[model samples]
Target: MKFLIDAQLPVRLSYLLKSMGHDAIHTKELALKNATPDTEINAISIREQRIVITKDSDFWDSFYVNQEPYKLLLVTTGNISNKELESLFIKNLGQVVDLLEQHSLIEMSRDSVIVHQ
Candidate 1:
């Protein structure tokens, strides 16, 4: 899967995804860097057919309200260290990928991954 990692997420997440054999890019790689607006991110996601991985609830709202981005992975694990976050991905990424293959919205917390209708 291809991914556009949001600014709120660590760039390391992109590397992890890439290492796992997925194409991924962090917001830092964009011309606006971490400052890229959500709308532009949405456009990129749609144009490139990338799943948006973000902690921002704004994307969540937009996903439901506008269906702007093609797909979304919303991280709801609040205030965790980057290592813990990466570990969470390592543990659940397979299931997450399977779910995303069939669903447009997914929520990942510290303990579980939820597939949204």
Candidate 2:
């Protein structure tokens, strides 16, 4: 899967995703950097067929209401350190991918990964 990592996430998360053979880009890599607006991110996701991985609830609202992005992986483990956050993704990403293959939305917390279709 292709992923667009959000501003709040560590850029290393993108690197880890890539190492796992998925294409991934962090917001800091974009022209607008971390300041890239949500709408623009959504647009890029749609254009590139990228699954957005974010902690932003606004994307959740946008997906529920507009359904513009092709896919979503919501990270709900609040305020974790970068290392812990990366570890969470590393531990749960397989489940995440499985769920993503079968659903449009997946919400991942520290202890669980839930699918929302």
Summarize candidate 2's per-residue lDDT along 1-117 as a digit string, tens digits: 899999988999999999999999999999999999999999999999999999999999999999967799988988899889888888988989888888988999999998888
TM-score of each: 0.98, 0.96
Tens digit of lDDT per residue, candidate 1, span 1-117?
A: 999999999999999999999999999999999999999999999999999999999999999999978899999999999999999999999999999989999999999899885
Candidate 1: worst-modelled 10 consecutive residues by lDDT: 108-117
lDDT of each: 0.96, 0.92
Question: What are the root-mean-square deviations of the candidates from the true structure over C-alphas?
Answer: 0.5, 0.8
lDDT for model 2 comes to 0.92
Residue 88 lDDT, candidate 2, scale 0-100: 87
Tell me which residue pairs clash in candidate 1. Answer: none
